[model samples]
Target: MPNVPAERRRVTLQRPGPLLIEGPVEVTSENGTTVSSDRFRVALCTCRRSSIYPWCDTSHRRRAGADDPRRAQPPPT
Candidate 1:
């Protein structure tokens, strides 16, 4: 998985709400700057209000059952 690109990386946002990013990732910006990390499995922010920037800080739980665009919508019954 080391040879794979970060952009190609994908994972599921489970019931617990953590971005389970899988491997060989090198987080970079448009400027080509590398954001170093200790591990390839990273939990990224989705609530858009994390004080920790990219990592989730349990903020999503505060808005449970609401129509959050970030969360996956229920399928049509």
Candidate 2:
């Protein structure tokens, strides 16, 4: 909005977690590719484990076990 100040925003880096940033943010890659978020807050992938890169899906918390969300589907026979 026009009322919003044009200033540097804050980014929070959580230990062993994604970067928490106030959103409506835009991220540009080294190759010039850009990603944008219009959310009020955003969790940026840090561990590079997200299937959706640049966005945190909590994939970094994956553990080798049967209770994992990544194992939602059973392997085909």
Candidate 3:
């Protein structure tokens, strides 16, 4: 029997949002920190604003308006 190559993983780039990747993935940072995800799909954060760092916690979502309290606001001084 001929050896078969594994299927290429698929990735979806959502406009103004996270990059969805087929997972069971491991991510390593320059600081030597590593993170692993076993989800069927993982949303990696592109914008540097995720409170969860490399993961998308829906922080990239657009606000409906200035009055949208769901938007991230600065900590109270």
* TM-score, per-candidate, Cα-based: 0.48, 0.68, 0.67
lDDT of 1 by residue, 1-77 (tens): 34654476678686546676865455664577666456768776666566664666777677654755677777999
Whole-model alpha-carbon lDDT for candidate 1: 0.64
lDDT of 2 at 52: 89
TM-score (C-alpha) between model 2 and the true structure: 0.68
Candidate 2 residue runs with Cα over 4 Å from true position: 1-6, 63-77
lDDT (C-alpha, whole model) for all candidates: 0.64, 0.79, 0.76
Q: Which of the predicted structures, 2 or 3, would earn the higher lDDT when compared with the native?
A: 2
In candidate 2, what are the lDDT values of residues 1-77, reduced to their tens digit?
43467667779998567999988888887788888888989999887888888899988666434455555686799
lDDT of each residue in 9-69, candidate 3, tens digit only: 7999975678899976777767988898889899898876689978988776643344466
- How well does candidate 1 match the true structure in TM-score terms? 0.48
Cα RMSD to the true fold for all candidates: 7.4, 7.9, 8.4
For model 3, the superposed segments whose C-alpha errors exceed 4 Å read 1-7, 62-77
Off by over 4 Å in 1: 1-10, 29-34, 65-77
- Worst window of 10 by summed lDDT in candidate 2: 62-71
Better of 1 and 2 by lDDT: 2
Residue 65, candidate 3: Cα error in Å is: 7.6
